[model samples]
Target chain A: MASAPAGTLYRGGEGMWSWVAHRITGVAVFFFLLVHVMDTALVRVSPAAYDAVIATYKTPIVNLMEVGLVGAVLYHALNGIRIVLVDFWEPGPRHQKAMLRGILVVWLLLMIPGAYFMMIHTIEYLFGSTS
Target chain B: MSLEIADPRSPGAVPSGRARNRGNFEKYSWIFMRVSGLVLVFLVLGHLLIMNVLDGGVQRINFGFVAGRWSSPFWQTWDLLQLWLAMLHGANGMRTVINDYAEKPSTNFRLRMLLYVVTVFIIALGTLVIFTFDPNLA
Candidate 1:
């Protein structure tokens, strides 16, 4: 059953894609949260230990990954709101597709500025000293 | 042409039922998701703003910044609540996905076992980290 040539389960529609994306982002965010909590807790270990760990985040590669993290978090959160509405609102089920489109726009509006703000430092760090 | 009424309520169906042996677990989970989600919107956004967008942003984050923040009981409590709420919210959401996707009984059982174990482990570890934190540790 795991291997099929024709079809196993139907996976189509924007709603299905949204569900897939939601699950993927949800897992990504959770993994990041786990690492984040552990690192934040390092403050209690020793100031130097925490400082050294956080200093590594300033690296160009890590800074670049920050953009992806921000995107995942923003989408996960906005989609989460849509899920709540679909679960509770009277017209939610009917309007879920509309909500998806609305959230996509909202996510772009928020993330565009967010990305600019987040990446400005990295951009400077990456290209500033090449001279 | 005639049509056949397939058993849509098959055990492997998507969201076969929202209820189980647990006492209103699904209902409360639904309610919890909505309430936690609304609150999390504020808490998570405020967190992102302060930690990643504010003056100095992630660059300024270090032991001292965290030590200063955690010194206050208010911030400690806030972090603690955010930890619990976000963990539970995300874990519960994953539980729903597992239920929907794990079609085989054996697969479902093992997947849920792993999920529960990992969820409980992370929550326990995070709670311990929050409550036992010592800013003065040297």
Candidate 2:
């Protein structure tokens, strides 16, 4: 069969977008892991030095960033599962579009509680709940 | 001159066997990404819960807290496996990205070389840190 013209389903639709999103999130998470390992490695320097560096992570700004990180990781993980199903399941291709919608719904559902739990400490601190 | 036809089944006429039996690196790399990704979904999400959402989150995590956790063989093993798996997984993912986007063959080789260097360095550093962490270091 001849290929569909450029703007068809496989070319510029859900499949493409999911592919783009996966690559973007994967790259972001990969770079973050590099920095995270380096930061964790600070323990070998000195406890004080390590604690001093980790202190930055506790700040409200970075706390919010952690929520974003969680979002990226969660999306990547869920989408990754979708990819696996597409590769290994017989009916996966037929249902991939529907699966993307399902993945997004699940991602949002998890992110709401995830972001809240991750940020609750920062929220409390900002409001003077703790010293 | 009469033309002679070579037999396809002759040893010299056939291609080398090694060509057909070359390694399955790409196939294994593809399989590795999927397998490791599935494992990481559990390991990383669990890690996030414990480190970022459970008690006080990052506020309570310091050197001592790290020491306390690494004191256990279980946690040490958990972290060591996590470091290696996540780093290798990320490296492979980045290599794919570079392969897809780099316009020139030379650029691809250079970028992947850089990626390998950093990936190996980070993995080695993380492994050493996890292995050599001293609880009593004040």
**Top lDDT: which candidate number?**
2
Give me the displacement of residue B117 in model 1, in angstroms: 2.6
| Candidate 1, A1-131: lDDT as tens digits | 23434331224555677888988988788778878877876766788988998987876688768778878888888988888888778898778788999999999998888877776778887777755
List runs of model 1 lying over 4 Å from the truth. A1-11, A129-131, B1-20
Candidate 2 local lDDT, A11-120, one digit each (tens): 66788889999999999999999999999999999999999999999999999999999899999999999999999999988888999999999999988888888888
TM-score per candidate: 0.82, 0.88
Count of steric clashes across candidates, in order: 0, 0
Computed on alpha carbons, the lDDT of every model, listed in order, comes to 0.80, 0.90
Docking class of 2: medium
Instruction: For candidate 2, give the DockQ.
Output: 0.79
Give me the candidate number with maximum TM-score: 2
Write one digit per residue (lDDT tens) for candidate 1, span B52-107: 77675788888778878888898888888888889888888878888898999889
Write model 2 residue lDDT over B28-84, tens digit each, in one string: 999999999999999998999899988877889999999999989999988888889
CA deviation > 4 Å runs, candidate 2: A1-10, A128-131, B1-22
